[model samples]
Structure formats: C-alpha cells, structure tokens
Target: MSKQPQPAARAHNGETRPSYSERLWVPVWWWPIAVAVTMLLAAEIHMGAPGIRAWLPYLVLLPLPIWVLLWLSRLRVEVTTDADDGRELRIGRAHLPVEVISRAAVVPATAKSAALGRQLDPAAYVQHRPWVKPMIVVVLDDADDPTPYWLISTRHPDRVLAALGLGTASEPEHDKT
Candidate 1:
C-alpha cells in the first residue's frame, strides 16, 4: 500500500501534526483460543464417529483453524494524518474523522480499568480487542454524529493522543455540585 504524507490537523484550534501511520490488529493472545477451538472440533469428529471416513473429513477441514484466526484478525485499524489536514482513524471498513473530536483519554490496562469491548459505553462506536493493552477513548461532538464516542485499542496510545491533539485539556469538566 502507498503511504500518505502526514498532514497537520486543526485540533481544538491548535495545530497537531501526525508523524506516522500505524495499523492496529488483533492482539497475539487471542490466537490460542482459536487453536483450542479447532482442536476441540477435530477431537469431536475423531471420537464421536465410528468409521474411518470420519477422520477423512478432518483433513479437508484442516484450514478451519486458520480461517478462525483470519476472521478474528480481520479488524484492521489504520491511524494516519490525511492531506485534508485531519487525523483519520480507519477501523475495519469505517473511517472516523478526528477533527471534530471533543475529548480523548487513555484507559489503563488493568482488569478493573480496562474498559474496552462490550464493557464500554453502549452508545459508543467501539473497535476494541481484549488482548491489546491500553485503549484510547474518544468523545465526538454530539451535534454532527450518531455515535456518541469511540473506544479503540492502540499499541502507541501516546502517539494516538498526540495525533488527536488531546492533552490534559481533553478531560471533561465536572460540575461543582
């Protein structure tokens, strides 16, 4: 694939330039589950059936394990600086514009703090992997979009935050009740 030149983004009225593009894929830890499932399937076929023909099917279905891996790995996320002077987050087949983003924060990798995947905001547009470490939580402007926010996993969350120009100011303001 051809690499696009990094572009300067107007983030919260300030210019934030992205230095490089990165694609985040499925974490390495999930592959073992796929292998286990495939092995279980093979075992079921081998022990349950009483004929020699039953084992023959396992050979034909040898690619099933790889297929499972490929399916899980299909969600590719590309973060880059576009020529339109906007930071882009290309997750799966969707492209999210980071220009109108209002807030961004880094989520910790601990069990209680790793609020990713199904544990995140239901109204949010999320693309998360359980095996990935820290995640980036981005809140978009509610006026222009249907998705309330986004929860994405990234290996280099600091760079992703930099690309979005989300510093300490990205934190939400709490009411003094």
Candidate 2:
C-alpha cells in the first residue's frame, strides 16, 4: 500500500494532513497520568514511616490511580510512516515501528492470549495475550513471512489502524458440495 497521504485530501476543506513528525509528538495526557500515579505510589512508600503524620501522605496516594484512569479515557493515537518501509506508532513519544512489532491485528473475540502468556480479559482469553501492554494488531499485505504483523498498544485502536491502512485477514470460505 502507498504510504503517502493523498495530496488533495483536506481535513475540513481547509486544513491539510499533518506531517509525520508533527503527528508523532502530539501529546496525550495519558502519559503524564501514568507518570504521576507512579510517583504518587512511590511517595506513599517513602512517607509510610512510623509516625501519625505518615498516614496522611499515603491517603493522598489513594486518588492517584483515579487520575490515571481519567487520563486513559482521554488517550489518543497518532500514526505515520518512517523514512524506510517501516510504520511508526505513537502516543506522545512512545513509538514502535513494524520491525519491533512481532504481530498486529484487530484482535477477535476468539483471539487467544499467546502474547500475554496468561488470561485476564476476553482479548487475553484467546491464544495470545497483549501481556497487559495494550496494542492494536495490524495484519499486513505483501509481507515476506506468515507474521505480517505489527503490534502497537494505544488507547485509540480504530483510529491508529485506519491511519496506517492495515486490517485483519478475512476468514476462509467453506467448501461446497
């Protein structure tokens, strides 16, 4: 598939499609949320000493996870192609190209936890699991091997796959008499 976006394509009959780097660095607050929550948890451990004041600092940590959840809810995906044939997956500096990816797909309900090595979510109940590292699976065409896959974990799976022009394989047809 062609990597270039249509030159004629316009965002709102006025705006143009963002360039590769511009698209890549757009910040999603989810990263900060993840960072903050981690810091809060660490602060709790540090402050959990032996005095009555120790309890107050840890109590402040209770809301850290909630902020992470809210940030996750607002997550976004930004995708683009690199200088080579590889594709770039981004959500605020967290990027992975096709080479780093072992597999990708619009994981089906029947898809197993082969990636995770354990079952937790229905997406994980299948053969491969995402290992809790959420990713969108993109099955590629014209690939050399059977694993024409690029796995990227992003909050916006649908948008990421659509931007890359990748998709899942169609099931085989049944034989008739």
Candidate 3:
C-alpha cells in the first residue's frame, strides 16, 4: 500500500500549525475486499427479488461497509503546539502534553510483541494497529497521572520521535546498560 501524503503545515497570522499529522488509514488492499464482500451480500439479498427490494439492498448495504472502513480510517496522530502546554501529542481523542513526557523511543517491529505483551504496563495508554508495525513509546513523568506511558502505532516512528523533539535526545534504557 502506498503511503498517503503527510499534511503540510500552513502558517496563518502567527498561528501554530501541527508539526506532524498522520491518519491511520486501513491498507489499500482492504477496500476492494470490503466492496466485494458487501456486493456479494447484496447479491444474496437480491436473489429473485423484484424492483425496490433488489435496489434497496444495494443502496443500503453498499455504503455500510464503505462507511465503516472510512470511519475506522479516521483515527489520527498529531503533534501540535498548545499555548497552555507547549507541545502536545494528539492520538485519536486523547492528548498528552510534551512537558509530561520524560522519555521516548522507537519500538522496532521485532520488539513490538514483547512491548505489547509481557513488558506492557497495565497503566499505559496504547493505540495499536496491526497494520502498523513500528511504534513510539513515550514515558510520562507526571506524578499526579496514573498512566505510565503511551504506546502508539505509527508508520514513521522516526518522524514521530523527531516531531516530539525526542529524536537523538532520548535513548532507550536498555541501550544505556
């Protein structure tokens, strides 16, 4: 699947635009499969049916799968500057202030299973997608907050780290030892 174009930041009247933005779209191959399945189901409903019954199923069922896929693809990840909080990482509906981020690292595809499995923290905030192999782990230092860290799936882990200003600055704890 071809990567979708990253959204370009535009400056308007000194407003701070998002430094990084990505929509976690489903794989391109999934679209055809979804359409085919919906069509097959519609065909089954249309079998020997006359007039509106045949057309109605197609009208109703056809858009249903497409709508579902589109809705699922709407999940977004963004890094933007906030007047009150400096920089903030936005994932879906949740936002994390950069100031609270104590450390960050890119979790390679090989370590992903372990990261999400045994090493996973129950108090962590995780936004995972199987289609996305790599992820960013951002450890939070806010003593008041119960969440330990954030495990977020991303196609471009390096870019996410850079956008968060953790690239080359924060290193994985395992590497120090």
Give the least accurate 10-residue stretch of model 3, judged by summed lDDT. 1-10
Question: In model 2, how large is the Cα lDDT of residue 176?
Answer: 96
Superposition TM-score, candidate 2 onto the true structure:
0.38
Off by more than 4 A, model 1: 1-33, 36-40, 47-55, 111-120, 167-177
**Candidate 2: segments with Cα more than 4 A from true spot:** 1-62, 68-75, 80-87, 96-104, 118-135, 138-150, 154-159
Model 2 has an lDDT value of: 0.46
Task: Give me the displacement of residue 163 in model 3, in angstroms.
Answer: 1.0
For candidate 3, the per-residue lDDT at 150 reads: 92
lDDT tens per residue, model 3, 1-177: 112353333454343568899999999999999999999999999999998788887898999988988988888988886444367788877877788899998888999999999999998889998888989899999888888899999998888888888884344367555
Highest TM-score model number: 3
Candidate closer to the true structure by TM-score (higher is better), 2 or 3:
3
Q: For candidate 2, lDDT tens digit of each residue in 1-177? A: 223333332343444332232222223565666667766775767664767665655566656766646544443345555444445655443444444444455544344345333433332212222323435565444343343444444444455555555544446799996
Candidate 1, residues 44-156: lDDT per residue as tens digits? 77886788867765775667767766787666556555455666765666666666678887776773253653466777777776667777777888575677778877777
Backbone Cα, N, C clashes tallied per candidate: 0, 21, 0
TM-score of each: 0.65, 0.38, 0.84
lDDT agreement of model 1 with the native: 0.65
Best by lDDT: 3
Worst 10 residues of 1 by lDDT: 1-10
